[model samples]
Target: MQCSSYWFCPDVWTAVILLILCRFRGCVSHLKINKYYTIKSEMAKDFPTRAENYAQWYNDLVIKADMAENSAVRGCMVIKPYGYAIWEKMQAALDKMFKDTGHVNAYFPIFIPKSFFSKEASHVEGFAKECAVVTHYRLKNDPDGKGVVVDENAKLEEELIVRPTSETIIWDTYRNWIQSYRDLPLLINQWANVVRWEMRTRLFLRTAEFLWQEGHTAHATAEEAIAETEQMLNVYADFAENFMAVPVLKGVKSPNERFAGAVETYCIEALMQDGKALQAGTSHFLGQNFAKAFDVQFLSKENKLEYVWATSWGVSTRLMGALIMAHSDDHGLVLPPKLAPTQVVIIPIYKTNEQLAAITEKVDIIVKNLKAKGITVKYDDRDTYKPGWKFNEYEFKGVPVRLAIGPRDLENGTVEVSRRDTLEKSSFQIADIETKIEHLLQSIQDNLFQKAVDFRENMTTKADTWEEFVDLLDNKGGFILAHWDGTPETEQEIKEKTKATIRLIPLDARPEEGRCILTGKPSSRRVVFARAY
Candidate 1:
């Protein structure tokens, strides 16, 4: 049966219904092409077209945009090639920076012995339940011969734990790899997969398995290790601001929020366009914790042996989720130029042989010049789709820039430049195309960061009392700066009452005299709190 609005307007119902279904389901399906009009007409009623429901908005953006999809295995994801391409661009940018900073990449074992984890008591306790244990090996034949069963006799005495992180085993190897003070700072980074068995997974945000780069370094002294920790945190902050174009608030996590076994944890927190907080990246200063656990010692220049200080920092595929929620809008993903796989794409709209020939000629020259300047470019000349289809496709893909050339422009000697970030279009002559593209790409990157910064500024609230804190979280839904009693009890109480946790204690936080909002105990300084991803 047709709906009232659609039945009253049958001719446009196809588009309306397709849009409605896509918005409600949060993704357009291949089977819905005939229902586009009707879906679109009712899309607004389903999605609300706002970031007020941030969790749903994020999930919708990731799945609806075709960036990624959930896999058959619970909490796991199949990173489609399109999503992987984005990761590749991110890897290329970050990997180059690591190399430039004198870091070398290495691979680590995916499975660590269960005993290795027991070496660090605190770390083991923190990750025990979340770790995936490999307890069995080969299975025996079933009695009915329908399936194989676990071989009771083949059970092993020891088990292996799929690494949630590589700190323990990496330190164990570092103990042997570093025997002298000369091998002081072993700056090693590993790009590989890690497993964390999360209860609930949301595409890229939380998954059973994900790819990431974990940097583990062992230093001769605590000072050097601390420096490495802070340095990498800064590196993460810089990358978030410049490459991903996501503005982050740099701070040190409170003890309650700190990574287990680490003396100090530094993190960069980013505000989503939806007013939620995502802990983008973290750097931990493990002051003798892992060194003592692994007995990693090095001979000092003074001819004595001393335990090394270690630091571990990592940023995961979750960065992709951060990018989407930080800059993307209802239209689709809006990638920063540096992180976009294709910074600029040329779409030629031509119907006649002369027009096709002219567009092909101009687009080829533009692609060549852009390539010479080290910009990634794509020319879409597929015959199956119209120019309007290609526009929506690239916009959905979030290419940083788009240049459109049609038959009309061929006679005028001009091309249309459409920027992805602002959706702004301007006409330009062929001669200045290269220079103009360079400026537009850089401008898009800058515009994205500034826009996020502005959103963060407007969303952050200062709460002086308990009621105000609850009210701010209930309504405003961003970071709350409030004084704490500096006790776990107070933190837990706030979390129990409100779903907010202490996101971070600013690295630049100052010592002040105040009272805890919950406990009324004398306190100094404040911690930022928000419901997190």
Candidate 2:
């Protein structure tokens, strides 16, 4: 008998009969079937929108884009190759800036003696809770053979503190390296990993261990050291604005918010899409603090001995989190053209080998031209995945410009271009396509930066009274420009009440007579306050 319905075919009827017989014989006591089932592609799963769940959306994007993931070690992360490539780009740009400023790269030991921390009392107190200490030198097999255990007999005479910041150790080394007026200006930078032992950790934002570059400079006078500090701050701001395409506010940190042993802390703060601020970078003026702590002194031009002035500045992988939150949408990452690892991706669509060969032949010329123009281009001609899959993959990975050429396009001597920033697609003649792609990339970068700038401008607002400050923080959730009494007690009180802290005191803030928003005390100028990451 022929089946009339597609769902109830002859095979279906046969299976039904077999099931009935098996059930009657108690052979299939519990039988179940799905009327219909559809397998969803992993790449097709949508992320939670920012409005729905901003935190989840960010976590999903980071993992889905193959950027990073939590590692076996708690509070630590494994930065995948794709994420590291972006970081490498940032390092390259900033490294050149450092070199231009007469800074040379150097290496410092990872393990610092516990005594080193004791040299700087405030520094030790600041990092004591977060430090990871090693008391034993070796581990031995367990007596029960379950696992290994720290060998008590192998304990060291002095415990070692894993380097949190290299101020103490770097200053100690500087003492030996500098002794006279000729070795006055010692500019050095080190690229290394540090362990902070954070209690709460996010993938890249607050990891226990992360990668960073710290610059430690020693100068003959305090004026020169301050100049170096400000110069590095500008470098960070430039890198953030130009390469990362994230707008930032340059300013000084309040005493409570300043870096632990620094006399003054300068920072560039960037606002994220979720209306929270993230400190993008910081440059700290040490003001002979470390030099005095380590007894690092030099012979002056007047034949007198004096302690050297010092400065330390650094930006960590937390900038990765800033980059992700600043501009990425719910769809996926929208990388700036300058920092995108694979800036241009070319995908060929074809049904047969001959067609693919023809498309590839054309793509090879396009790739060659793009490479000659110094563009990082990828030609994805793999037959394992369909054209649609490849398209979604690159889009999610934030490839700035995507070019697709099918047989029809090949015949017409044109290619379809898609810009990731806007998800806009258009067809253009393949003639001089290299120049077109380059211009499109620049336009995307500019658009992303402007969009961020506009968002920040809209989110920033002024609050006059304590009520207004509390309302703005609880309801609007952005940077609030308000008068502070310039006292740590008031800062602490505001934080305790509203969970908002002063983000920065603007460098160019004009002198405007005002009253403190919280205490109604006299104030000089308004400070930027925000709930930050």
* Overall lDDT per candidate, in order of appearance: 0.81, 0.86
Report, for all candidates in order, the number of backbone clashes. 18, 0
RMSD of each: 11.0, 15.0
lDDT of 2 by residue, 1-533 (tens): 33344443333112100000111111101111111112333554776666656777789989999999999878799999999999999999999999999999999998888899988877877777777777766545567655455557766687777888999999999989999979979999999999887767888888889999999999999999999999999999999999999999999999999898899999999987777788989999999889999999999999999999999999999999999888776568889999999999999999989999999999999999999999999999888999999999898888999999999998899999999988889999999999999899999999989988887888899999888888887777779999999999999999878778899999989988899998899999999998888
Which run of 10 residues does model 2 get worst, by summed lDDT? 16-25
- Write model 1 residue lDDT over 281-373, tens digit each, in one string: 999999999999999998999989899999999999999999987777656678999988889989998888778888999889889999988
Error (Å) of candidate 1 at residue 143 is: 3.9
